[model samples]
Target: MILPYPFPLDIQSILNNKNIFRRPPTRFGKMHHTITHPFHTPDQLPMTNQRINHEPVFLLASAPWRESSLWVEVFSRRYGRVALLARSARKRQSELRGVLVPFVPVSASWYGSQELKTLHRAEWIGGWPQPQGRALFSGLYINELMLKLTTREDPIPELYDALEAVMRAVCGENSHTAALRRFEWTLLNRLGFAPDLFHDGNDEAIRAEETYWLTPENAVVPIEEAERFNPRNHGVAVGGNILIQLREGDFTHPESLGQSLKITRLLIDNLLPEGIKSRQVLQQLQQFSFGV
Candidate 1:
């Protein structure tokens, strides 16, 4: 009969039977005691208890947990956002030290039925370059967006692909702003918060000469109609031409870039009641650079 929870098994017994080298104790002592049962081979454990192995993932964030462990958040191609407990990851010689880094792609394995899974293995898949400078900050902003907007275990493969593409674009010279705008738009669209750029709330096609305001309800209002709309529900004013440009995924125009940034930021802020920490950091960094 299947247990409601994962049955704890001895790591030593499983590893020994598989001839895998035993891990030494961590600095805190007795690290082996915290190591969970191994499922290196599918046949070693019952089919119901088999570990999910080598799933493609991108490390979003990590924090120190117990003495020699880490609490990690990863964006898996197959599993979306996942919370993983990486045992002994903080140890000096642990292989995970270099592997668990943001931006770079890696394959991760885990096993558990609980909300938090136990990380079994991770290996670097190494194709994309690690973003640096402003690009690095941009990458962090995207990570924060993912963490804030996505729920765990909800697979969004399209969003994952967009993230990878945006990261690459951000790393390229002169593409940071455009890449970020596109990514923000893509993310909002995928999450069902995208505003109707081509049409107004009345289902009227947007005219290039007309100005409109993007509403929190993901609708656009003509400026004249917006004046009559509830004052408390007002949105950021955007040019109809810019909205059409954004809908076409073109942010090459200076005005288009600025308007897109303001509009997307407003939408994202509306969704994230607690606000995005990384965005604040990014703004501070921008201010400091201007001051310098």
Candidate 2:
């Protein structure tokens, strides 16, 4: 069986002097309108915006819904995390199948008062290139973090901007490591879970030569000063230089990368007790050389 180029255009249509699809119905009234899009607008942007369109979103996850539709999770600037039901999106001629993919910047219009909004329409907002290889996994990891840590409808505009910027940075092979660390810090900070990296638990300025311990209670204690407080558990111990590097936010020192990972891993897992599956996937992928 074969399906033609997809377009959910209405039956009634007119051709201009150029014989183009003039004012073809773009609204999502019914799911039966099946037309191929061998010739469609550039980047698959809807020829018109007859419905409510919000900020561009990144598709986090999508799955089959019924026989012809799809249930998707997306992170947007305005709405944060949202679940959408895209009707007739699985039809061979439907235009949304191509746009509702992970990592793509999509302009999506939806409506509903319930937790799941009905997808009115979608279009690919093409501009930046998608991540490939390990960066791709890193992208998935970010999506998972958004899903697990972020609250639905609790819009964090700054976090959205940070995410969008990191998405672009991760496209570069070597930049993914630095970009992921920066994004992780931003996420933790936005969620109010990040500690004051600049100041230690003792409220003293961290010196580069000292050794510090990160307590389970989210405080940094210098090893030399720990005897004064007689704290029971000092938690993971790290050099003061590593703590300072984390504060720098750039991970300029080669050692900061690994130390940053250890620090963030401990902190994030404490928040997500169920664990991040994407993180596990990344760990497992370490055995294989994708040259990324």
Candidate 3:
């Protein structure tokens, strides 16, 4: 993935910098325990004129803002994507330093009426072990998607759940291509950009025996109709069976997996005009690393 604009902060550099975060504790520590909070729908969260405390969050991206402060982006279950200013976070003993790492679930508190809020507190919650090696890049790729595709303050709880599920799956032993595909599909569906795999442009129910083209405009059309409309850019030719499999979230077949990947890539590229940087890094690693 190639982003239109370079990220202000380099994730690789941050990961390499040993002084950025403190070492993890051996067992349950003051800041490493689970947070208990009353369950509420995202809409129930205070939108204005109040401070939100200990909201469940997953750090998406961060960058240095001003002297001793960090600009943080997080995906909150209650508030969606939020921008925060962590003051004095660069200080060696600042509480926010260790708590702000990516991929871990954290309970964060912030106060402000403006677009960017002020971080008051952050606490790490237990989660699956951090993704390593290729899984790490894949996790970063997922973060880039969240950062690019989601709008700040627009809450989508389902997407948040999907993120956690995909991250856990990606960190496991096997390559999680199916998990990634499912996540991409879920994200697009939540954002209302998912193509109707079960129906064609005319809204007719797709037949399992028919072949169709997934058009650039995100419509499914019968191969014959697509050829008549425009043969040059009728989209990628996919089998009806594969489309059905994708619609049902079943990627058991290699053909379905391949077609799903193509379709998801097209949809994500359509949304992210600048492309994704982490994806480019992943491709590079795969190309150079022997049997990565």
- The alpha-carbon RMSD values of the candidates against the true structure, listed in the order shown, are 13.9, 15.0, 11.7
Of candidates 2 and 1, the better by TM-score? 1
Q: lDDT tens digits, residues 75-106, model 1?
A: 88777777778998877788877788777678
Cα deviation in Å at residue 15, candidate 1? 32
Best by TM-score: 3
- Candidate 2 error regions (>4 Å): 1-52, 225-234, 285-292
Name the top lDDT candidate.
3
Which residue pairs in candidate 2 collide?
A: 5-36, 5-37, 6-36, 6-37, 7-35
For model 1, the stretches where C-alpha displacement exceeds 4 angstroms are 1-50, 286-292
Q: Rank the candidates by lDDT, best first.
A: 3, 1, 2
lDDT of 3: 0.72
What is the C-alpha local distance difference test score of each model? 0.70, 0.66, 0.72
Q: Enumerate clash totals for all models, in the order shown.
A: 0, 5, 3
Give the per-residue lDDT digits (tens) of candidate 3, residues 17-101: 4442222221211122111111112233355756999898988877665577777778998788887878888777787766787
